[model samples]
Target: MTNEPIIPTRKLLLVCGCLLGLTALTVVAYYVDLGVFHTPVALGIAGVKAVLILLYFMQLRYSSGMTRAVIIVGLLWLGLLLAGTMDDALTRGWLNVGAP
Candidate 1:
């Protein structure tokens, strides 16, 4: 195994601070009411949070390119599956209330 330097405590604190700040931002964003863009904005913030966790908490930044590629592909595949499911759900006639 290669001799990799350990991450500094300060850096870890900084990342934690950033994650906390982003969490606060997400909470604030919820009450802002951007209408049609609300979901996209929330999703974008969540994506940033996920990346930070993946890179630092999961130590993916120090990993090989193949590992990163596999993760990206997996996330994309999951996204596609979710999107397809949402599409199908939206197209279905569930309640059968017939246009109130």
Candidate 2:
């Protein structure tokens, strides 16, 4: 598939909508107390934003095979990195992560 926009008009609108939605979501998430699930909710939202960026803005949805493979590889590396970091942070920190 060519890299040309399949629906330039709609894609542009979707990108804008995603951005605005993310902004609104972040604002609302900040105000909404999630108690024990706060971090999970925030992370879930952030992951959604990342997927939107990769699938739409990055145009991976219409990308070449090699490009898609590269993106998948990069995401796998990122997951490994985040997992390692989280393991270290959680194991090391004595700080209060949850709300009172």
What is candidate 1's CA lDDT for residue 77?
100
- Per-model TM-score versus the true fold: 0.77, 0.69
Residue pairs clashing in model 1 are: none
Q: Flag regions of model 1 displaced more than 4 Å.
A: 1-3, 91-100
Model 1 vs. true fold: TM: 0.77
lDDT of 2 by residue, 1-100 (tens): 6656574878768887987898789779978888998888888888888888887877777778998888789889999999998887776646666523
lDDT by residue (5-43, candidate 1, tens digit) is 667788778888888999999899999989998999989
